[model samples]
Target: MALPSADQTGNMAEMEMQWAVKAMHHAETYMQLLKAVGGKNFKLTPIDDELYSDFKRNFPDLNIAVLNDDDFKTDMAKAKWREFINKYENRVTDFNFGSLLRIDCTGDYSEDNTMFVMRTQFYCIEIARNKEGLNDSHHS
Candidate 1:
């Protein structure tokens, strides 16, 4: 495969960095929000209850209480997420664009455990987690 020019490589790096910063900021803001108002009381939207139920219905095997990549790394998962993510595409901008998600929610979002996922996937999982008080200990 042809390699990118130096300028292209530089631009790619900058873009990646920008994505990371923005994604991390999203996670940080969520943590702060959770801290500001206990996770159980925090709602990402007026439809949080519906979102939580939908997520569970879509991924019955997913253990939001404790996260792991196994539930989301299979071919079936890719197809499942593709369908699940598309359900909100019209309502949420950049719904399928990549966002960083911590595989282990009990800790911070870091390169070590982070996985790239669609923005809506992040919201779906996170909103449910927060509502369930599973992500209450992030410490912002």
Candidate 2:
């Protein structure tokens, strides 16, 4: 198949950017809603112990345990992660706007703990967390 032309690629990038912006807006809304119900002190835990262990069991290299390890906390580690994650590029479709991944469920929010990643990955990690009631809104 022929590669997309420059115009096509540019249009796609523009669409992706718009989608990402909208996604970020929705995330803000979610944050507000969760805070209203769960309290201003609320923070979404990425996953519970069982899920975390399962995630590590399935993809040991991407486990949360290694997140702060010296070998995985450097620029080279980030690059390595990108390279490792790219291996799944063909499996994902219906791209979502980039979403944030927070390292700690507690403490003040900052760029230090948050990682922006593709919508699919955010959904993959968060869907389970949500399903498990990590992000349940208690206001109702």
Q: Which number leads on lDDT?
A: 1
lDDT against the true structure, each candidate? 0.76, 0.50
Write candidate 2's Cα lDDT for 24-71 as tens digits.
675666556655765334333333344334444544555331134443
Model 1 stretches astray by more than 4 angstroms: 1-11, 138-140
> In model 2, which runs have C-alpha deviations exceeding 4 angstroms?
1-17, 38-57, 60-97, 107-109, 127-140
lDDT of the structure predicted as candidate 1: 0.76
Kindly state the number of residue pairs that clash in model 2.
0
- Which candidate has the top score in TM-score? 1
Q: What are the candidates' C-alpha RMSDs? A: 4.6, 7.2
Please give each candidate's TM-score: 0.78, 0.42
Question: What is the Cα-based lDDT of residue 12 in candidate 2?
Answer: 76
